[model samples]
Structures are given as structure tokens and as C-alpha cells.
Target: MDKIMMWVMAICALIGGVDQLAGNKFGLGRRFEDGFQLLGPTALSMAGLICITPLLSLGLEHTIVPLYRILHLDPGMLGGVLAIDMGGYQLCKELAQDPAIGRYGGIIVGATLGCTITFTIPVGMGMLGEREKPLFAKGILAGLCMHPVGILTGGLMCGVSLGKLLFQSIPVLILAILLVFGISRFPDGMIHGFRIFATVIRSAGTIGIALGAFSYMTGLQLLPGLTPLDEALKVVSSIGIVLLGSLPFAEILQRLLKNPLEWIGEKIGLGRNGTAGLLVGIVSALPVIADMKRMNEREIVMNAALLVCGTSMVAAHLGFVLGVDAPATGALLAGKLTGGIAGVWMAWRIMK
Candidate 1:
């Protein structure tokens, strides 16, 4: 499966590259270019955190590990508090006694639970208008309710035993339930809290980058265990490379799926925007969230629910997984897609 995916990416890269050389007649080249364009923002968001993960892991191991052990859980599960690309993987690896659980936590839980906390809630709330916040909050609450489906599915796909999966998920379920309650009862407070949390993470990432750059330029290391800036950048570059293909491939997929999605939307009583949002949200949630003005209330809520687990499956998340752990790409895909679909259904039922 890994090899097949690699070949698929390579083929997509070739197609994207050729389209670029041919002056982007099909506009596929624009997607190719977008991959490179995203590198700067991606690095700004994550590189520093990656560099400083070892330091953070040390603190977490000392403070949190004992509690997790007492609960018969892996400390790596704590990494699910951060987004996958934002040092979650590194932190999980550093703290895990079990490598499989680390992968499960960092990739599966991180992408779903972690991304929702750090990126989805804060960023999505910030992007939407005041009028839309309530609807969005409700959708997120619905999404949170179904997040376990994705986490458990992904865990199983990652070869984690059912007993361990259930045990390890205790903390995630608790946190998710809290999030659900917070968003449902105190939307404004939850939004404010997440914004503060996101700000702290970004600030820490910037400091990590600065410290790494300083250490690289000078022979002296200010922090004893910081990863080199260059090393972190290398990981970013790898994801960028994968994105070159993934973005173009996503464009191709959107084109191919448009008619069917439209037909499905019509049958399901969803408007054009809602159907379109579902397809687009898979590539990245930002564009869909940004364009929510065109959507009706149903569409807005449904799209939000989908974004919880579905966002970036075909683009950023896929690129990141392929770059870091190619073998887990299938599990990532299955988890996000299935979970996202379930979220959408849950939203529909709630709205009904």
C-alpha cells in the first residue's frame, strides 16, 4: 500500500510538473505552485515547535507521565493536545514507551482531536462572522461527539489492540466531552480559551525557531536538547514535496467528483454550496470556512461538522503523513474520511 501511494504521488507530481511546463493550461500547475507557496506558512506554524519538542517532551514526561502510567495509558497520548504537524509526532515519539501507540496518538488522535483543539476551533471561530459563530459552535459540538469513531478506527488500522485502544482513548474521550460541553454552554469562553492556547503555541514555536537559528549560527547551544533548525526545515521540505502532488491530485479529484457530489447533494436536500463545501473541505477547511457566506444555515453547520475530522485529508494532512510515516497513510485516510462522513451524518440528524 505504501509503495502504491508513493507511486501515485510520483505520478501526480509528474502530471503537475508537466502541466506547469505547459503553461498551466489545465490550471493543475497552480495547485503545484500552491504546494511551494504553503511551505512558508507551514514552517512558520510548525518548524519551531518541532525543534523544541524534545525540551517540551522532557517536561511532559516528568509532570504528566506518572499520571498517564497510573491510568494505564501511554504518555504519548498527551501529544494529541497539539496538531500533528505542530510537534505532536515528535512529542509522541519522544514520550512513548510503545512505538505503535505513539504512531496512533500522533497521527490519528493528533490529526482529529489535536487539530480540532489547536487549529480547527480557534482558527475556524476566528474566521467566521459573529452571526455564524453559534451555528459553527453547534456543528463543532456535533463533530466532537463522533470524533471517537475516527480515533478508534484509526487506532485499529494502526494495528493497536482493541483493549489498548479503548484504554488509551479514555483521556481523549474525557477531553472531547469537556470540549463539547464548553462549546455548547460557553461558546465565547471556549473560543477565547482556544485562542489563548493557540497564541501560546505559536509564540513558543517562534521562540524555538529563534533559538535553533541561534544555535546553528553559533557553536554554543543555549538549550541543551533543541533540535537543529535545519533538521526541522528538512521535515517541512519533505511535506512540501508531497504537497506538490497532493494538491494537484486534490484538484483532479474535485473535478472528477463534482457531478456526483452535486447529485448527492440534490437528493439529500443540500444546496450547491453545501455539497461543494464537503468536497473542498477535504483538501483544506480554510477555503470552505472563508466562503461560508454563500451557504445556508444547514450547509454552514454540516460543513463545520465535516471539518472536524475531514479537513486536509487530501492535502496538508496527507502530505505530512506521507512525509513522516508512509505506511500509516492508509490508516490516516480511512480514519479521517470515515469519521468525517459520520460527523456529517450526525449533524444532519441533529439539524433534523
Candidate 2:
């Protein structure tokens, strides 16, 4: 019965996509009923988010671990993460600057917080009394600013502080930044793989690389270990880690900061719950993001906002992986996921 209830919720959440469509419908709704006018960038962003889940699920299990261990210098693995992060951040940042992308800032604001709260806070809760816990949190954030969070966590696990590590990483960070920038400049046509169905194939390629590395280095003798099903979840989880960790959770945060009222409003039951519902609606309304709003521009903005909030789950989940124990990642993930999706839906009803 518990499992059934969860399935029911998931299904209901998925179906919220329809609400988005309905919201956009002519004459009676928010304003932008004709869904056909949705922005290409927004649609592309939606497709990218949806596509990554399945792709990550497909192949990383067999590849990533071995590759990372073997080379002990897996630039490809790190580079892939950086490329995706930089591209998405740069794109969203640019979008935010455009008045066209500015209106739906609320959704983006929600999504960013969702991912951050989900990933980071839960980890924080666990480390409350632990002597080493604070170090871990500081390490993770500092690492994000200085190096890949994973590597930084790995370093912190090795007992190094960011100040001690930053000088050593200057060369690497500069290189990573350049690599990401270069990838971003790829001919828009070449990069359009994110749009094409074949892009899934491309994404899975990274998984294959990562898994192959993991297995070869570990020397795991089990035959079943190489199977696709065996690796699917782990691989997908890691890509998810990268996505949740890398997305513009902070920028979304900046936008939210811009509006202090949300803080006061939350006291009256209009803040967190409202944001969660909006996110729930976003996941449900992917196929028809434009339907969630009456204005075309607003619809596009809403979709971006939703994507940002959706990333909270990743942020919270990462906290767990980073080793913060007390405020467990499990609790944070659940709370944020619930809050993010619920927030969006609530916003829809209340605002309308």
C-alpha cells in the first residue's frame, strides 16, 4: 500500500503537465493559451533535462568507475561534467539577462533552491555534532568554486583545506574553464545533438567511458558486473549528481534573494509549499510547458524556473554522497522534492 501510494503520487505529479496546458489555454487562463508559440530555447532546455535521465540510465555503470580509477587522471570524465555544467549555466545566465527569459524567473528561482536545498542541507543536518562534518560542507562548496566537487571531496577526505588546495588547482581550474568555454563554442549545429534523438546516444557514450574505466581498474571478476542492467542505476545516479551539482542553483538563488517577500510569504503558508507545487507541475507539464502560462514569454520563463528548481533533488542528494551524516540526504531529498513540486502547483492555484 505504501508503494502503491508513492506510485500514485508519481503518476499524479507526472500528469500535472496537463495542468500546464490548461493554464495556457485561451480566454479563461493566465494569458498565453496557444502553446505553439513556446520558445525554442525553453523547449530545448526541457528536452535536455528529460533526455539526460534516460541517457544516464543507459551506460555509465559499465564504464565510469574503471576509467576514473585506471587513468587516475580521467580528464574526460571531469571534462564532461564541466562541459555540461558550463554550457547549461552560461545558457541560463544568458537567458536570465534577456527580458524574454526574465519573467519566468520565479520558476527558475524555485528550481535552483529546490536543487540546492535538496543536495546541500540534508548533508549539513547530519554533520551537526560531528567534529569533521563542518569541514566536509565547507570543502564541498569550496571545491565547487575551486575544483570539481567530487575531487574536492576526495581531497578533503584526504585532509586538505581549500586555501591549501587552491594554489595547486589554479592551473587545473583555468584549464577546465577553457575546456568548458571551448565546448560551449562548438558550432551550434554540432552541439544540436542535445536536441536530436541521437543525442541520447551521445550522452550514453560518456557512461560507457566511465564504466569501462571503473571495471578495468577494480578488476571485479563478476561477469554480471559488465551487464547494462547492472550499471544502469549507478551510472544514472552519477550523471544526476553532476547535473544537480552543476546547475545554476546559486543564480536561481540570486533571483530569489532579489525578492525578499517570498521569505515573509512563507510564514503565511505561501512560500515553500507554493514553490514545491510549481515544480510538481513542471515535471508533469514538460511536454507542454507553454500551457502552464497565459503569456508565451511567461510560459517560457516558468519552464526555466521549473528546471532550476527540479535540480534541488540533485543538490540534496549530493550532500549525502559527500559524507555529511546527521541531517541525512534522504530527509532533505524528500523534503525538497515534495516542497519544490508542491510549491509550483500551489503557485498556480493561488496566483490564478
Candidate 3:
């Protein structure tokens, strides 16, 4: 599976690179460029956190571990509070008693649930207009309702038994329920809370980077277990490399699926903007969010739900998994795609 994915990425790179050099008539070149362009932002968001995850894990072990263990859950499940790229994998690996559970928690749970809480809710609310916020919240609530399907599917793919998966997911389920209630009942407050959460994460990432740089330059260990700045950056670089191919491949896939998606949208009563948003959101959610003004209320709500687990699946999330855990790429795809589609279906029923 790893070899096949590598080959696929290599082929994508070849095509993207050639298209870029040959005047980019196909526009795949832009996506190829986007991969590199993402490095700075990605590093800003995650590299620092990665460097300090070992230290964080130690603290978690002392504080959160006992309670989780008492509940018969893996401590690694706590790491799913952060996005996959933002130290979730490192923390999970560090805290896990069971390696399989760690991988399932960090990659599968983190990408969907963690990403939604840390990235999607805050960022999505901040970007949309006031009128759209409530609609977006409704969509997110719907998505949250269906998130377990994705997590369960991904867990099974990671070789976790259904019973074990459910057992370990107790905390996650509780937190998710809280989130749903918060978004549904207190949209404004939840938006504020998510923004503050994102701010705190960014602040922590910045501090981690500063400390890592200081440790590296002075050859003095201020923090005993800090991951080297260089090593953290290397992980970021690997993800970037994978993106070089994933982005262009996503572009190609979008182009091929464009007509079929439109046809499906027509039959399903989705607007043109909704169909376009679904396709674009796979590569990145920013564009779709930016263009929400063109969509009707139903489209806006559906998109918000879809993007909860679906955003960047074909691009950023895929690249991250392929770079970090190549074998889990299939699981990530299955979890995210199915979870996202389910969210859309649920939203349709709710709207009806």
C-alpha cells in the first residue's frame, strides 16, 4: 500500500512538475506551487507544537492519564483534541499504551474531530458573515452528529475492534456531545470559545518555536525533552513534499468529477454554488467559505456540514497522512470521505 501510494504521488509530481515547467496550460502547476506556499503557514501552525509535544505528553501522563486509565481508555485519546498536523500524532505516540490505538486516535480521530474543533469551527465562523454564521453552526452540528461514523470506520481500518474502539471513545463522544450542544444552543459563545482556543494554540506554537530555536542555537537544553527544531521542520517538509503531488492530483480529480458532481447536485436539489463548494472544499475550504455569499441557505448549511470532516481531504489531510503514516492513508480517506458524505445526507434530511 505504501509503495503504491508513493508511486501515485511520484506520478503526480512528474505531471505537476512538467505542467509547471511547460507554461502551465493545465493549471496543475498552480496547485504544485500551492504545496510549497503552504510551508510557512503550516510550520507556523504546527512545527512549534511538534517540538514541545514530548514535554506536553509527560504533563498529560501525570494529570490526564490516571483518569483515562481508570476509565479503561488509552491516554492517547486525549491527543485528538489537537489537529493531526498540530502535534496530535506526536503526543498520541508519546502517551499511548497501545500503538494501534495511538495511530487510530492521532490520525483518524484527530483529522476529523480535532480538525473540526481546532481549525474548522473557529476559522469558519471568523470568515463567514453574521447572517451566515447561524447556518454554518447548524451545518456543523449536523456534521458532528455523523462524525462517529468516520471515526469508527477509521478505527476499524486501523485494526481496532468495534468494542475496543467504542470503549476508548468515551471521552471523545462526551466532548463531541458538548460541542454539539454548545454550537446549537449558544452559537455566539461557542464561536468566541473556539477563537480563544485557536489563539491559545497559536501562542503555544510560537513559544515552542522560540524555545526550540534558543535550545538549538545555544546548545543548551532549556527543556529536557524538546524535539530538535530541525527534526520538527523535517516533518513539516515531508508533508510539503507530499502536497506537491496531492494538490495537483486533487485538481485533476476535481476537473474530472466536475460534470458528474453538477449532475448529482441537480438531481439532489443542490445549487451550483453548493456543488462547486463541495469540489473546491476537498482541496481547501478557504475558497468555498469565501464564496458562500453566492449560495442559498440550504447550500450554505450543507457546505458547512460537508466541510466538517471533508475539508482538504484530497489535499492537506491526505498529504499529512501519506507523509507521516503511509499505510493509514487509505483509512484516512475512507473515514473522511464517508463521514463528510454522511454529514451532507443528514443535512439534507434536516433541511427537508
Candidate 4:
């Protein structure tokens, strides 16, 4: 199975790489990018769990066990909130606002806002999924505009509080949708500003992960009696390991899935590389990026829109790692796919 999967990945990478070298939009077909996108998060998270958080979030057991055991909390519903919150934070803050996006604080805001406040799987995935900053902007706007059918469904599965759901979560969710609609009225031209608040934050992604990894290793508390440094550090470590040692496997995995994904995509009537896109997370968009036929600007943007707006294995994994209940987990998976498709179609119409 490993060999077969590896062969698949290699062939996919080769085809995608050839397509890209011949003048494709963004997918360059390097093992480096592919590996970083797929394995980066899991690697960083695992290293952190083993080192920093002291197994507080070691596995499903540690992450959600506390909800049931120590805190005497409902692992199903409230866990959904935490799951959504963590996944959103990871995607929006940690992953968005990259070099691909601008370096300004506003880009961060734009990325976060465009990716949607509550639904943020796109920000991270878009970093690699399309690698085009404008598409990120467009997709973010589209993602934020989506209705919270899946989110509400997930919350319901988790047994969330009725009043809180109706009043707090539902209200904010509606407001966010309104914001997206409002933003849609803005012009489509790209403008630039020269001020960058903190150039350091731009590079801080891998650095943050490294610092967290070091902290995890040495058991050092940079700030005593402060926030949960250990947990924070560990999560950072997990996010940072993309460069450390996760790319090779990520590249292999990307290649293996390409042909099958493309085949599935053709069946579904998604241009050409649709399935490749369905699987395109942050950086491993080689399948879509390398497709020679759909190299136009609109095609590129649409492909990314689909991934961020439609697919979200990353969010699902984060929820699973955090020990969200099965019902909530199902909601996250189903909701992102459904919402993403809706967002993509809407963005297509909104594009002017």
C-alpha cells in the first residue's frame, strides 16, 4: 500500500510539475510545498503534544478526555465550540495573512475577515491551495459570506446550550454573514499600501513553531503564571514543523492522490482538476495548479474558491484531534463541504 501510494504521488507530482514548468499559474510542483501543506500541521501538533503540553492534548484521549473527566463538561456540544474555535484560530490567525497575503495588519484582518470570522479553514488552505493573493481575498470574502448551516448543525450535535446557540452563536453568525454581503459591494480592483505593522510576524510562523518546539523540549516557561504557555508553545511547535521534517511524505501523498482525484473530478463535471482541488489543502494544490487547460485567472481563482469554500479535512482533523464528538465531527466535515460549494458558486456570481 505504501509503495502504491508513493508511486501514485510521484506520477502526480511529475505530471503536475511538467504542467507547471510549461507556464501554469501557481503550482510549481515541488516536494517542499506539497509536504509542508499536508504533513506540516500534524507533525507540529504531534511534536508539541509529546513535548510541551505534557500530554494535555496528547491524543484524542488527552484533548477531549478532560472535557468529560476533569472539567465535568459536555464533550459533545461545548467541545464543538472549542473545536470550531481552535480550527478557526489555527486557519485564520496562524495560517492566513502569509507572504502570499500582505504583510500589513490589515491584510491579516482582511484574510481573517475574508476567510470568514467563524469559518476559517480556507485561510490556511488558500495559502497553498491557490497561492494567489487576490484569490485569497476573493475566496475569503466568499467563505465569510456563507450561511452557518453546518456550523449550527455541528453545535446541535454537540448538545450546545439552546439559549447560547439561539442568542449568542446564532446572532454573531448572522452578523458575519451580513458583513460578507456588505464587503461584496466593494470594487474588485487590487490596491496596495506600504505600511507593514510587524515584519516579524510575517516570518514568525516557522519561528513560533520552533520556539514552541524548543520550549517543549526544555520544558521552559518563558512567562511564568501567564497564559497556558505550554499548550500554546506546543501548538506552535506543531504548526512550525512544516520545514523541519514533514514535506517529503506530504509530497508523496500529493502525487499519489492526483490521478484518482482527477478521475473522480471528471465524473462530477468539475472542469478538469476538480478532485485534485477537492483534496487541495493549504500548499498541495499541485493537482489544480498544474492542470494546463484551466490556467486562466478565473479558473485559478475558482479552483481555490472550491477548496477553501468546499473542502476541509484540516478542520476535521483539528476537531478530531481535539476530541469533538462524532456528531459534531460529522457536522464539521459535511458543513465545510456544503458551505464551501455554496460560497464558491456565490463568489463566481459576485466576481465582476
Give the whole-model CA lDDT for all candidates, comma-separated: 0.90, 0.32, 0.89, 0.39
lDDT for model 2 = 0.32
The alpha-carbon lDDT assigned to residue 233 of candidate 1 equals 97
TM-score of each candidate structure, all chains considered together: 0.98, 0.29, 0.98, 0.46
Q: Clashes in each model (backbone N, CA, C under 3 Å)? A: 0, 58, 0, 15
Taking the tens digit of each residue's C-alpha lDDT, what string does model 4 give over 1-352?
2234334434544554564566644344453344336444544333332232222223434455464445432222211211222332332222212321111111122222223332333223333333454554565566556545434443344344555444424433655565555444541321111012112222333344565655556777552322233565454444333232223334445567788767754554455444555556533333544452444444455555654434333332322322311223333445455665665665566653
Candidate 2 C-alpha lDDT tens digits along 1-352: 2233234323432333344456623221221212112223222323233223333323443555355335443212221221222122222222232321211111221223323222222322232334323322222222123223323333333333556434333434564455334323542332243234234434444454454446556855323333332343343343333322222232233345444635543543444433332333322323223232322322232223333223334322322222212112333334334444443343333333
Tell me the deviation in Å of residue 265 in model 1.
0.7
The candidates, ranked best first by lDDT, are 1, 3, 4, 2
**Greater-lDDT candidate between 1 and 4:** 1
Scored by lDDT, model 4 comes in at 0.39
Model 1 reaches what TM-score against the true structure?
A: 0.98
Candidate 2 vs candidate 3: the TM-score winner is 3
lDDT of 3: 0.89
